[model samples]
Target: MKYSFVIPCYRSEKTLGKVIDEIQAKMSEMNHQDYEIILINDCSPDNTWGTIRNLCSKNENIIGINHAKNFGQHAALMAGFHFVSGDIVICLDDDGQTPANEVDKLLAKVIDEDYDVAYAEYAHKQHSGFRNWGSHVNKVMTEVMLGKPKELYISSYFAAKRYIVDEMLNYKGAYPYVIGLVLRTTRNICNVEVNHRERTEGASGYNFKKLLGLWMNGFTSFSILPLRIASYGGSAIAFIGFIYALYVIIRKIVAPTEYLGWSSTMAVLLILGGLILLVLGLIGEYVGRIFISINNSPQYVIKNIINYDSVENKN
Candidate 1:
């Protein structure tokens, strides 16, 4: 079967060549001559695009795509999915942390077991503390919001069948969450344990703001649990306010001369006002995404492409 490797690169100029070389070596060992490598540069400020162009020039099987601006990793993956012509599409990081030599494990599961997708599960991840925490947050969010199975671990490195990729492309919304898209598509997914390596180069691309935005994307795009929680919270708060009003009336009737402190009134007002604003902001986020989708926003804009003579880009 033909294999397609889709890697979303950012600030990976130093290590991307090695990753590609490892993939080539692995394919050769497996006797997989029919394969393609798709490298997407997500507007990295470094010489990543230059490196991709160089690789494309050296190997006709390599395809290079340059984004106009930074669109995050998930957007880059969606962009790459459009040009996949292989039976099995593999997605992995640009960095060397995801071991390319162990890709056979993931591919074996998909090919032997007939699974729709197989995610690479690491025994001990080599990410920094902050990145690990971000990954933890993402794991919890997927389980709670996207109905992901608790036993199945999701990572950036995974192998998916062509049908699964095709079903994922049906999502035309502006915000695309890869985990949510996969979970919604099929439950016939498994995990393969693989060794994670330490980063020999730059740091991670995700910061606090980007991680928070990713969480919001997962929350708003795939589920309505947050909105339901907001509704329930409002009802509970209203009930408490009504009960407090009755208490105040009882106290007033029992002791007319007692002083009702302004502090308590202000405290209640502040709490209710804060909650109202929070719920409004949450609603605003959902509406804003809907508006952007209705306006037909492109997920990612491609500035240039190399070795795409036969394939037409649909983005």
Candidate 2:
């Protein structure tokens, strides 16, 4: 069967070529020929695009796509998915940490088990404590949002049947978390244990702040839990205020000599003020998503596109 591999490259110049070489070797080992590799450049400042161009010149099966701006990895993946023409599509990071050879195993699971998607689960994660914590938060949020199995491993490395890819592409949202999209699309998902290696070079693109932002994005985009929580909180606060007012009325009626206390008034004011802010923040989050969607913002811009005969030949 024909296969397409979509490798999303950011500042991956350090190991992109190595990953490609391993994929080629794996394909050769499996005696597979009807495959193409699509390298998407997410406007890396490094020589990642240059390396991809050099590889494309040497290999007919390799195609290159350059973006006008740096969209995140998922946006680049979406762009690559749009151009793929294969029975199956596999997405792998260009960082070389994920073993390209193990792709065959994922493919086997998809084919043999008749699964829509097969993903790699690292036998042991080689990331720091903070990263691991962030991953766990992401997983929990995904489970709460999409209602998928909590154990489904969401990795950049996965092989999907053509229909799954098509279904994913049909999702047109600004905040497109690929793992969530896949889970929403199909339930025939399986995983294979694979090795995860340390990064060959360069620090990760996501720092603590960026990771927190991603977490918020995933939470807000997939679920309305935050909004619901805010609603419940406001209602609870209002009920407490009503009870307090009733207490004050009873106290005033029972003890005509007693005066209203300043401390109690201040406490009530502070609680109400805090609740108002919390509710506003929740509304802001939902409004922000709607504003972003209505603007028709492109997830990733294409500064340039390479290897498409139609565009290249036209010029």
Candidate 3:
């Protein structure tokens, strides 16, 4: 079966070549000569695009995609999905830590066991403390927001059947969250254990701001749980306010001279006012995304592409 490998590259000029070499070596070892590698440069502030061009020049199976701007990793993956022509599609990090040599383990779940998608579960991740913390938050977010199974761990290194990729391609939102799309698409997914390696070149591209943006995308794009939570919270607060008002009325009637404290009243007003603003902001976020999507904002604009035909990208 033909395999398509899609890698979203950022500042990986130092490690891209080695990652490709390992993939080639593994494919050779497996006797899977009918494979293609697609590298997407997410407008990295490095020579990543140049590296992609060089790789494409040496091998016809390697394709290079240059983004017009830095649209995060999920958008880059969405861009790569447009050009895939394989029975199975595998996605992994451009950094060398994803263990390309052990991809067959993920492939086995899809090829041999007939699963739609298989994720790589690292037994012991080699990321920094900050990245690990972000991953943990992401895991919990997915479980709560996307209805992802608690046992199924999601990572960058994974293999998906062509049909699953096609299903994911059908999403047209400006903010494309890959994990949310996959979870909503099907439930027949599993994870395979793989070894994680430490970074040899640059650090992770994700910082606090980017992580917050990713989490917002997860919350706003595929789920309305955030809105629901706001609604429930408003209801609960209203009930409490009603009970407190009744108690105040009964107490004032019992003793007409009793002073309803102004400080307590101001505190309640400030807290309720803040909550109102928070709920309004959440609603505004959903509306803002809808407006952007309605305007047909492109997910990722392709600046240049090598070894690919002139086909329209469904951004």
Model 1, range 1-315, lDDT digits (tens) per residue? 889999999999999999999999999999898889999999999999999999999987888999999999999999999988889999999998999999999999999999999999999999999999999999999998888989999999999999999999999988899999999999999999999999999999999999998999899999999999999999999999999999999999999999999999999999999999999999999999999999999999999999876333411
Across 1-315, the per-residue lDDT of candidate 2 in tens digits comes to 889999989898879989989999999999998788999998999999999899888877787999988778788899999888889999988888889988889998999889999989998998767778888887887788768686788878999999998998986778777877787788999888999998878867777787776776677777788788888888888898899899989999999799899997998899889889878887887898889989988777776666766423433
TM-score of each: 0.98, 0.92, 0.97
Q: Please give me the total number of clashing residue pairs in predicted model 3.
A: 0
After best superposition, candidate 1 residue 231: deviation in angstroms?
0.1
Off by over 4 Å in 3: 310-315
Better of 1 and 3 by TM-score: 1
Q: Report clashes for each candidate as comma-separated counts.
A: 0, 3, 0
How well does candidate 2 score on lDDT at residue 35? 85
lDDT scores in order: 0.94, 0.85, 0.94
Kindly indicate the candidate among 1 and 2 with the higher lDDT: 1
